[model samples]
Target: MNTKLIAALSVLLVAPAMSATSLDLGYKAYTSDTRDDNAGAYNQPFLKLSHFNKADWGTLFAYVKLENPGEVKDAQHGADGKLTVKSLAIVDKQIGSSNHNLWMQNFLVSNRTVMEDNLYLGLTTNQKFGDLFINAGAGINYSAASFSPTNASFDGLSGAAAVINARYPFALAGLKHSLTVNYEGQFGRDGEHKQTLGYDSYGHQLITTLKTNLTKSVYTKLHLTQFDSWGATPNDGIEYGIAIGMSF
Candidate 1:
């Protein structure tokens, strides 16, 4: 297994032992009309397992995804054929006497099939604007895939990355619903690396999801994502999907 995957799994295994941990397993089926430069369009279904832990020190979130299950040649297959793992840990530190929103964040993500292994460490802050909550962070990003023997792997210090996540929740017609928008981007990479990787110097993704509960444990999601670029491909497309999931 890759180091990224190992680290993510290790956290997942240990998180349940911590106080205030929640686990969720769900299956998502969505079709994307967007086309990848190399793999074209992928419309396969995926299963996701996620864990969240909150503690006095900080919080941790981890997830593993199995995409295109049982299909060997699916367009979306990654390093472990169809497995993708990601984990994020936030360590809380009061910047000032009253700044409780500041935190140190570490994010790790890897997908062998896509040939990506990346890590980001930086500072983050959370804020609330009316009924909307937002979390933003910026930091350095390193890709272990740069050293991969694979030809198209992203390598070295990819660049600086920034992320923003915002959510708003409301009740409509006696049903609870939430809308979330997430943006992630990498910038300031070498031009040669960009060309070699078949991507732009600035690569990013903006995703918005609207989720509504069908029952206490069952919910549905609508996703719309704009991919500016990813992995070894230059993807500029809008992808949309609908999914149903049950949380326990």
Candidate 2:
């Protein structure tokens, strides 16, 4: 196993003993060849651990993601195909105990040469009608990027972008199914990379997923994701991949 994978697994193993209010463990494999430069296609296997705790207003969340163990081949170009950590605080309110309103703020950092850090703030509205559930949200994202010192085309870059997403979930054949679509567009620049604006400039990701209950505490998931702009630029050719995941 890769060192990153082992480390992620170690965290998951130790998290439950930390007196967590709630904890989730997951493992997945993702493969795709979509990028602006096309030289950065990668096959990534990763692990995730999430912890949630009740807070005064709502919930406190912490997430850890590990990918690309020991510098896998073809992994770069802002993919952040490395170690990443995220922290968020979310508040959700129910309207008459039916509709839901959610607000969250998060910060993320990664050890990546293309892009290293990001911040996100968003709000979402969720509703269920009959057997269908839907969620929509919009947010602001700030991201910073870095490049190698040997061959530099553009210096380090940073920008603020608009992020929007929607998700629809329903049941199919007694299995849980969902489709999520996300869009990001940059309007302002924080660095010299002003050419990074337009439709799908920041990102356009679509994911379809199915989850099957295997046991009370174990479930299997199959998902497909199309990363339209891994570099947040057009003509980057859609990078698509399928992932099989298990969660507990």
Candidate 1 lDDT, tens digit per residue, 6-100? 56535544334354333333343323444434454455566566656654444556555555556443555542234445555544433454324
Please tell me which predicted candidate would have the highest TM-score against the true structure.
1
Cα RMSD for predicted model 1: 4.9
- Native-to-model Cα distance after best TM-score fit, residue 209 in candidate 2, in Å: 2.4
Model 1 is weakest, by summed lDDT over 10 consecutive residues, at 21-30
Which portions of model 1 miss their true places by more than 4 Å?
1-33, 36-40, 72-113, 146-154, 191-196
- Among the numbered candidates, top lDDT falls to 1
Candidate 1's TM-score reads 0.74
TM-score of every candidate relative to the true structure: 0.74, 0.58
* Candidate lDDT (C-alpha), each: 0.62, 0.45
**Candidate 1 CA-lDDT value:** 0.62
The residue-level lDDT of candidate 2 at 37 comes to 40
Candidate 2 has a TM-score of 0.58
Which pairs clash (backbone N, Cα, C closer than 3 Å) in model 1?
Answer: 78-112, 78-113, 79-112, 79-113, 146-155
